[model samples]
Target: MLVPLPSPPPPASIRTQVEVPLALPDGSTTTARVVTFNGLVDGLEHLAFGLGRYAERHTAVGSSPATPVRLHSECLTGDVFGSQRCDCGAQLRESIVQLATEGGFLLYLRQEGRGIGLYAKLDTYVLQDVGLDTYEANVALGYAVDQRNYTVAAQMLLALGQPRVAMLTNNPDKVAQLRRLGIDVVTQVPTGLHVSDANVRYLAAKARHGDHTLDLAQLTGAGRARPRAAP
Candidate 1:
């Protein structure tokens, strides 16, 4: 069952766009038409990047070869500072390359720390250091395990004329949430695992607790010791 938004969704429209060339750490470069939206239900400044022939491609609803899309939440530590405590930075980079090749959109959402805000996330890290898993740390701080909402994501997609999409994510909840919000997710694409000594436990916790589609075998076999089983 789905709970409706508090109010009817506000009409959304393209507010602006700019062509920006992106240079990745891997020495690859591609240009994206970055877009901003107006009239989003939540007034946050979420952005969408049009990649790989988005301007020339057919964007009709239910068009063949549904547009590839990745809804990326903001991660300051990983995305900006190159922190390896999580796989966020790697996933974002991979998404750009893949979306660019496939011709799609990347919705950069301003959801930090799973929607708990930056300060709270740092507090959770203290709990995590003392043996709490990610979700447990969030709960210990009196926050929901995950508080991300996709209504805004759906709204952005609808405004962009992409009623249907092929979602790039390992989290099934993202797919389910989008479907419930009137966005047709025709495909669910998984990202490669980014396992490291610093983030092995974090990845395992996501797979065990959040039901993220990650390979435990590969996680443990990535030349790193296996994290203890989740409680």
Candidate 2:
């Protein structure tokens, strides 16, 4: 049985998609209110608490309900105010941009630092500095390497009438897990990483240990980064 996820406060509606101006370097931004679906169980408007509702958000944007969807875990530091520690912010930005063009839904699940939470994740950072890889860092902190659960994703997909998906990810585990849950995974939308000095180590660890299915050789074509080699 799935762990009973906590629900948001009684108000059925938790988001007000207000059009606020975002002060950007080049310009401002107009976006849907970013809600913590995992943080507040009932925060998502019309999203009834259910099996995969934790990390999934469904919206009926177009009159027709054939819009594609994206399943993204929570990366608080990156997804929220931009943080250069990882490529998460960039990937989140890219996903939003791409999804906007296609008119699809993005299920932003709250799996901060792959569900380890910021505080403990920071401790893991200390372990990383001491030569521990990302997974090892988590283990050092007495946590699973990847504490994320995709059952909520499956539940949300079914809820949004997206019983299928053309996933935007490089991780085969995500694809396999979703498939196992009976979500019709059409294909993968390889969202490449924007190589940066700060995130080089994080990205390298994914390829080396995290079992992510990104082709290192292909990444090299886009100018391979010399990340801090993990111990």
Candidate 3:
């Protein structure tokens, strides 16, 4: 269930903004401004990137609907070290390339391990190795399947002057949560990356229980199936 937060006192606010050169996968360089924010609740820092000259504008320009946005949570093992336990690193890289070309923002939230923290996530991994699925492992450990909340994400978007966006995600919960928090999600752009054998079942579990719109057969190359359309 998605619950709305009562526009709490800006959980996140920009601390500093700087322009930096971004290296693309095609060996080309693009300029983007990196905005760092301080979390009022957790006291942690979160980062967001504004691509192209639009960085100076802050909000989305033109009358062509909302701006493109990707709300990516922190995954140190998968994103930084490229762990195969999940497809996070691949999705992050894909989001970067897409955002760079399309001109949008990528909010890198500091909610590691779906908000369970790293140590507990590692324990869940051990439980997963013993035959439990990701959600089951979390439940067995007496935690919600997903402890992450999108309140901070919504506040960050509002702070960036982007109250609406064409969200880049496969999770319906994200759309619902954001909308509930007053962020209008105009459309959902799926991260249609294929899955590996190392995490096929993990992805399947998410699709089955997490309400993620994914075609496991297509992702795993088991068939030529299409993902379900967003609601």
TM-score for candidate 3:
0.87
After TM-score superposition, the amount by which residue 13's alpha carbon in candidate 3 deviates from its true location, in angstroms, is 3.8
Please give the RMSD to the true structure for each candidate, in Å.
Answer: 4.8, 7.9, 3.6
Cα lDDT, all candidates: 0.84, 0.59, 0.78
Candidates' TM-scores? 0.91, 0.70, 0.87
**Candidate 2 worst ten-residue window by lDDT:** 46-55
Residue-wise lDDT of candidate 2 within 65-130, one digit each (tens)? 334556677777777777776777777666565565555557777667877778887788888887
The superposed Cα distance between candidate 2 and the true structure at residue 161, in angstroms, equals: 1.1
What is model 1's C-alpha RMSD? 4.8
Q: Which numbered prediction scores highest in lDDT against the true structure?
A: 1
lDDT of 1 by residue, 1-231 (tens): 134353325568989888898999989999888889898877999999999887333444557777889999999999998788888998898888888887899999999998888899889989999999999999999888998887788888888888889998999888988887778799898887887888888998999999999888788765353332322
The TM-score measured for candidate 1 stands at: 0.91
Distance from true position, residue 125, model 3, in Å? Answer: 0.8
Against the correct fold, how does model 2 do in TM-score?
0.70
Q: What's the lDDT for residue 24 in model 2?
A: 31
